[model samples]
Target: MKARNRTIQLVILAVIALIGLFTIVSNLSAGPAKYPQVGDKAPDFALAGLDGATHKLSELKGKTVILNFWGTYCEPCKREMPALQRQYDKWKAQGVEYVGSNIGENAITVRGFLDQYKLTLPVWLDQDQAVRKQYGVSEYPTTFFIAPDGRIAKKQVGEMNDAFIESALAELVKK
Candidate 1:
């Protein structure tokens, strides 16, 4: 009886091991994730803004779009908001679109932050963080500079200076 039980247990364990191995092999066969890179078409997403509008990225095609993924809790993000607003002020009339995506924060908190900073840039609420994952954003203040033709001109991973933004904007807006 003991030998029979042992044999059954061994068979079950072997089956489990084989299943695990198969899963691993199957996962390995799947290719790596492809995120939007510079020159690739930026993925389109529609998210509600703090301004009570559902902003869609595809609709902003033919204009240079600054899609910034930020979090209210991130200090670096906070540091850059003013600079972004300044650039927006300077460039909006020239056909630049600003899409500020606040990741995983409630409207009230985001509102308070924006208010406290006196920043006028329109912020899109990424309440569920779906757009963050779509953009493969692992950090705060990841900014994508999309060209007038809807291609990604640059992907900035951290806090941006006024100078860097100005230069990128120049490249983006050049005739």
Candidate 2:
């Protein structure tokens, strides 16, 4: 009886080990997942604004769209807001849409941040971070310069300056 019990336990352990091995092997075979890259079609997303209005990325097709993914906690992002606002003011009338995609933040928090910064740029609230994930934004202040044709012209990760933003806009317009 003792021998039989030991055998049963060994069999169960072997089965569990085999299952774990199989799972690992299957996952390894699946390969790395793909993220958005430059030259890819900008993924479309619809998110609400702080004012309770829904904005869709597709609606801005045929316009140069600057999608800045930012969070309230990121200092670099905070530092770049004024430059973005300046560029937005300068180019908004020229069919350029600069949108701040506030990642994983509530309307109240976003509202407070905007008020503190005195920023008037249009901001979309990405409450669930779905838009961020879609855009492959792994860092704070990842800016995507999408061309008028909806292709990603450039993916600027981290904070951006006025010159960089202006040059990117120029490139988008040239293409």
Q: What is the C-alpha lDDT of each candidate?
A: 0.92, 0.89
Residues 1-175, candidate 1, lDDT per residue (tens digit)?
A: 9999999999999999999999999898776877889999999999998978898999998999999999888999999888999999999999999999999899999889889889888889998999999889998889999998999999999999899999999987995
- Could you tally the backbone clashes for each prediction? 0, 0
TM-score of decoy 2: 0.80
Residue 19 alpha-carbon offset, candidate 2, angstroms: 28
lDDT of 2 at 88: 89
Q: Estimate each model's TM-score.
A: 0.82, 0.80
Q: Global lDDT for candidate 2?
A: 0.89
RMSD to truth, every model: 8.6, 8.6
- By lDDT, the best candidate is 1
Encode model 2's per-residue lDDT on 1-175: one tens digit a residue.
9999999999999999999999999999789766778999998889998768898999999999999999889999999999999988888888899889998888888888889889888889898998888777889989988999999889988889999999988777766
Model 1 Cα shift for residue 113 (angstroms): 0.8
